[model samples]
Target: MNIIELFEELKIDKNNILLASPEDIIRIEKQINVEKRINPDIDVNVANNLILALKDYRQELYFIASNRILYTLFSKKNYSRHHFPPLQREYDAEKIQSFINQFLNDDLVLYFDQNLSQNKFDMINDIFDFKNCFPEDALFQLNKKLNIKLDSVLVNLSQNNSENNSAISYVEYRSFYVLLSYFSSIEMDDKIRSLVNIVSERYNANKLSDFYTTCISSMQGYVAFDPGLTSILVRNREAAVSNSIERSSSGSSSGMSGKSIFFIVIAVLKVLFLFAKCSSH
Candidate 1:
């Protein structure tokens, strides 16, 4: 089905849907037969799906839109004679950034040192010029927000990874691993593999390798967090809270009689703690 149909079928609120440009909406609308104009203020049901689709297809869309914008800019007669616009006429970085921020709101970054290959590990040192490229303040915020412990080893690894791989592919792999390392069990692995397979098939990939390559190449930055365990945490948040409340209530009741509630509370707290820790990573 078309995007609009999918959205309508899912009853997504239009306001929750953010776009980088009106042109983007127009383009998508043309590609898909949207029976009615999407009212930004009234639609929200499919916001999650929309966000997921956009992220899963981000690099492809980003590259396409960037190239298109560049082409449009250069296609004009005075292109080379003047400086580039602060932003392109049809590009809205803020809107895109907002979408990004919203997408990442529910997710956390996970790091894995052991899963990284040696060559991949070393390339991090060569690519990123720390002084010129990365935003120090943003990086600091990222570290603080995600509880990422920045060290020479991690920095060295990232820089080296950036240098060794092709510009497009390098960032893609890094993003993939950054998301992948969060999966800790065979079940999560299966989910990832299934999602990858679905993405590959949707994109009409001929081989598993090709599908994986394209999937990562296209969707790198769009993936804000590892959804494997975090999704479970989100789904169970209310239940977790309810269980805690129940334990607390039980504790209050038992404290007057026996130590039953105290043990139950401790057990519940331990489980909650484990869930939180797993979800956080």
Candidate 2:
């Protein structure tokens, strides 16, 4: 569908037409707010898809305009009260699904050139072996199976243009950090981290200590912060290691005893205290 048609189908504001026009960037600047007004409860991906569609329609100065569009869509004004997730593949399916489905409508439309039902069967079979499934998986896998293009038109717009707008570059940097924070929640995947680093370096935002801190904080139930805004990425790793070590030490699968558990808890608390004290410095 054309940009305007897609917006209409999605029930987004007609104001988005002005936003999608390539004549100027003014309309794109107001898009996030307009989107909020038109559908305050829209899903994050739907909002992202809309912005991407608009940028694609504008078709100007690829990366710069696409970055600007993303900035407009995900500014502090838009996302401070309501955080949207970055695209990441390593997340637990259920958690990722929750984020994806948060603003989703039951009747949300999926556009494709082929019937997706066939591949859904194979995907369901293959994914069950992993013992986990996400609501989006069936469709994503089906798209993969059918060679359906899941192209975002704006992503094509974000090509290297040589001419750099400092403002747009800054927005790109922010978007990269936001993406990093969103993806870090998933089980830390090397590929995802590498992508974040690439985007960070590309936007000259390699110093992302604060961003990591925010990501750790977003990891609910994990006391994963340091005063210097250093992340607990290692802490989770260490916990996993400790669990393995304890499992090995115990030898049997029955579980640890009350006395052993007490001692282990004490040791953990002491280690945490020591780590906290060391971090304070």
**Residue-level error in angstroms, candidate 1, position 53:** 11
- Alpha carbon RMSD to native, model 1: 23.1
Off by over 4 Å in 1: 1-92, 104-141, 145-281
TM-score of 2: 0.20
The lowest-lDDT stretch of 10 consecutive residues in candidate 2 is 148-157
Alpha carbon lDDT of each predicted model: 0.35, 0.33
Q: How do all models score by TM-score? A: 0.19, 0.20
Per-residue alpha-carbon lDDT of candidate 2 for residues 215-259, written as tens digits (9 for 90 to 100): 222222222222111233334233333444555687854443444
lDDT of 1 by residue, 91-140 (tens): 44444434333432222111113223322422222212221222334334
